[model samples]
Target: MKIISSKIVITVLLVFATVLSFAQKDFQGQAYYQTKTSLDMNFGGRQMSEEQKKQIAERMRSSLEKIFILTFNQSESFYKEEEKLEAPAQGGGNMRFRMMGAGGGEYYKNVKEGKLIQQADLYGKQFLIVDSLPKLNWDMGSESKMIGQYLCFKATAVRKVVGGTAMPFGRNNNENQVEAPTEYTVTAWYTPQIPVSQGPSDYWGLPGLILELHDNNTVILCSKIVLNPTEKEKLKVPSKGKVVTTAEYEKIAQEKEAEMRENSGGRNMGGGGRGPF
Candidate 1:
């Protein structure tokens, strides 16, 4: 009787373990996000002149670029999602570029230099569904929407700042100080489907995968979703350019702009004489 009981216990344990393992979810998908941005240039605490705005707009369009990557794997007990984005010895190819000219003349200029570095942050970053719960402190008012068969909810996230120091030249000198950090809000739409809880860019931490997100000024929309592609590969973390951190990048950019302004003596904001337009 004792021997029979032991056999029955071992069989039940094995079955339970198998079931538990299968209960864990694993998925692989492809998604594309589009962003539309508008630049508001300010000079001397006032709005920039029309001509100045145009020049700044051109520069802004040339400077901004998006950086991200794709990965593939199976869900398993030992799987660590964050490890998938470690730095690759060969480095990930540059993904951001500038759209030059209009119509037939339009072309792309790779802009992976200077302060705009690409590095994935695993500490402060959180995947949408994996991190968020049903309740949050922010407002949840949103229209019902569907994304890839999953019901989505919209919400806004606001970040406010009163005063902060600025390092306008990627320098640690005392001269690099100004009130900046500024206040802004980001609104996003998410869905409960696709269980893993991830999204393009730095936006995440929602009850579901973020399908569409915007900051009132910048719009990022999801165009498509691909599920379990045949390709099985790993995601590589992007390289960190000469400068790291958004603050450091801004400082370097600001210093460059200041130098350009000084060299031009505020006369010629555009033209070949100063430098590349």
Candidate 2:
């Protein structure tokens, strides 16, 4: 009887310890992010006057800057664009160009379940792109930086960047296409205090929440963070769209994009008139 009583006491103590640990950890929060892309107008800069280039840069700036909100809890996150802006359309003129990038969809990631759902649209067609959650193999660094009073530690990872190349110098009408992935180093600064494996877009697998991320010409920084806010947060999984695997959606997207470009006679710029989802 005494041995059983001691075992019971030990079990009770263990349960109490687990409860304390869980209560102290924060798992709910909202992170506001601002993304900025540095435009390279060098392609047509020399051909145009200084004033014209400035105007183009201004337009690009307006298009490139965007705001996003990422609400997360523990191992799940939902990221969405705050503003849905219309893509610029060109009306058959001398020059045809527009800023281009990805991530115009409802992004949801569940690290615990190893699931990722992206509600995407390509040329008026809706698709639910399903794939595994992004897993970044990070090399933690001793270097540190402060982002909005939160002390963040630096980490780096080599990631494959897809769809980087643009149409070469030519009419680009009836040219072939195959998007190949290229390797690029991604730099991130995360705060360990938050203890959530999350970042902007398709980046994850850090020891903490990533505060700032840099990838080539684009940079995403966390502007604000609210931990366990008074407002109720819902990080629900999205389930409304034409479901398709990542490979399937890629094939469909490429085919649709090619068809649109051909239909527009190279006049369509900025993803061939695809709207932000």
By lDDT, the best candidate is: 2
Per-model TM values vs. the true structure? 0.48, 0.75
Could you tell me the lDDT of residue 226 within candidate 1? 62
Q: Which candidate's TM-score is highest? A: 2
What's the number of clashes in each of the models?
A: 1, 0
List all candidate RMSDs to the true structure: 15.8, 9.5
Tens-place lDDT digits, model 1, residues 49-80: 78867755654442332322223222211111
Each model's lDDT comes to 0.40, 0.67
Q: Write the per-residue lDDT of candidate 2 for residues 1-277, one digit (tens) a residue.
A: 6755554465355445444332544657889988887655545112666886677666555446888889987788998888666667533233433333434678899888988898876655678888897677899866765687676778998865433255422246445433334667879998766767888776789877899988656788999988778785788677778998876876666566556556666433333212232
Model 1 local distance difference test score: 0.40
